[model samples]
Target: MSQPSDKALVPFVSVDHMMRLVHRTGLEEVLRGLADYIEADFRRWELFDKTPRVASHSAEGVIELMPTSDGEVYGFKYVNGHPKNMKEGLQTVTAFGLLADVGNGYPVLLSEMTLLTAMRTAATSAMVAKYLAPKGATTMAMIGNGAQSEFQSLAMKAICGIDTVRLWDIDPAATAKCAANLAGQGLRVVPCASAEQAIEGAQILTTCTADKQCATILSDNMVGPGVHINAIGGDCPGKTELAPGILTRAGVFVEYPPQSRIEGEIQQMPQDFPVTEIWEVIAGRKAGRVKPDQITLFDSVGFAIEDFSALRYVRDRIAGTDLFHPLDLLADPDDPRDLFGMVQRAAPER
Candidate 1:
């Protein structure tokens, strides 16, 4: 076998390469870039083919495939959420994604989405907060200090001008880990004793706990008026984080109602419970925060379109750089009709 042509190889961003790329480009810069891409796609949301993620549930966890296409490119992510994994010294969520040319159906880029998902999730939160968060909001209450805590804090800082993050978790060690990681990241990190304490004096309240149950991370009385709630943890059918009273009081916003109604905080509400799509708010077709006293809730259930945007951003940003390796993932024969001949010709190398 000679050398494989470039068309047969897809660019693969490994975990190491992704870390180097984030370091080289600056982490906050990448977060802001992802936010921009997500926002841009949201502005043209009607152009994409959207659907709820396909999920397979088990006793331990759930695996999902999120897919979307915007006429030119198609993207999908394979992700798993296992809250029990944390206690087993493993990641609660891990993912990988691919982007392909819609016309030719050949993958153009493949990358680890474990880091990318964390970044994009935070970016999506902050971007929505930009439109719905109280004006001039600078402080955010980070209620969950898990793997996503640092990314969410920095994204808010970089994208929404938030300079202070008050961190809290049921586990003090988790809060300590989050605070220590964010110590020198240009934000004022305060360790709070409880979730209520974390939200004190904060304009934006972010909840990201991982219990895999309908536990109330934020109670009704704990949440006051005029704060924006970025609820991102409840991503499965039986998982939730907020009180029903909070949802009834807040003006709820969602990415896609079909998915959010099944997997978000709004899952606690009735089937006909009113909710506004965040894309409409982003496109200026609906209201965001009309009054300071009105509570704004973004019941975020991770959507496929956001992953498509993040994948698109990674593909464009990694070009002309040695941040990814070429993966011989596809078999490209000289003649499209003779796949057997191409395979037989390569058998001698084995």
Candidate 2:
């Protein structure tokens, strides 16, 4: 067999490799790095192609294709959300993604994105909290303790200086799992019996449930003044975590207003319901949290640009490291127009 050319290769990061990469750079540092990249991209938000994720929904779950390009590089992620998978001892969410050079349309990076998604989601939450959470905030209420709960807790601790996390979930085992994972991570972990107890004295409230329906994991009555709400589980139509009244009372910030209106907490409200893009706030073009007593909400539904940023970050991080495998994902013919000839020439080796 003949060796393939360099152009035929693509860097692939597996789940194991992703974990190693995270450990190599240090988890908290990687979280901070992702947050920086995401924030930087958001500051130049208008330069990218922005659109809602293309989704295929069914009774079982939904599969989505989130794609975007910053004129130089194009990236996309294939992710799925199936709430019932947990009962069957499977992951509720799973994903993989790719980044390509737009000039040549050749893939540059391919990576498993299930774990990356969790990390970026938490980083984004913390980044937004850093901008909107009250001054000197140190405690956060983690309203759900599932696959994403621990990451969310650590991200807040790393990025927002949150020293304590109050956790609550419908399932006690989930809370126990999250707590066990968080041990010795430097934060005071508190397990609560109810969602109401979790939010007590918590300056930041993060709700990340897995259910695919319109579930009110955080009610208006449960929320108090001067808290930043990070609602991430409310993704896709009919899936939400915050109450309608809460949206009405808070200053809602979103990644992209068009996508959020269809898939975020605002889906429960009227079409004309107002929302401020977090990029505007980050860019100093709009206000984030004006008053100490005012409520702030980051209605995050996982935008494509964030994934693009993650792909970009991963590509840079794995530059000289063995944390990624080189995959022969493309056909590199000696002559660009000789694809058929190359295939025909391969019959002898077969």
In model 2, the runs with Cα more than 4 Å from the true position are none
- Which has the greatest lDDT? 1
Error of 2 at 176 (Å): 0.6
Show model 1 residue runs off by greater than 4 Å: none
Residue-pair clashes per prediction, in order, are: 0, 0
Q: Candidate 1: lDDT of 14?
A: 98
Across 134-219, the per-residue lDDT of candidate 2 in tens digits comes to 99999999988999999999999999999999999999999999999999999999999999999999999999998888998988
Q: At residue 253, what lDDT does model 2 achieve?
A: 95
Per-prediction TM-score to the true structure, in the order listed:
0.99, 0.98
The clash number for model 1 is 0
Candidate 1 lDDT, 1-350, residue by residue in tens: 86788999999999999999899999999999999999999999999999999999999999999999999999999999999998899999999999999999999999999999999999999999999999999899999999999999999999999999999999999999999999899999999998988999999999999999999999999989999999999888999999999999999999999999999998899999999999999999999999999999999989999999999899999999999999989889999999999888888753
Q: Provide the global lDDT of candidate 2 against the true structure.
A: 0.93
When summed lDDT is taken over every stretch of 10 residues in candidate 1, the lowest stretch is: 341-350
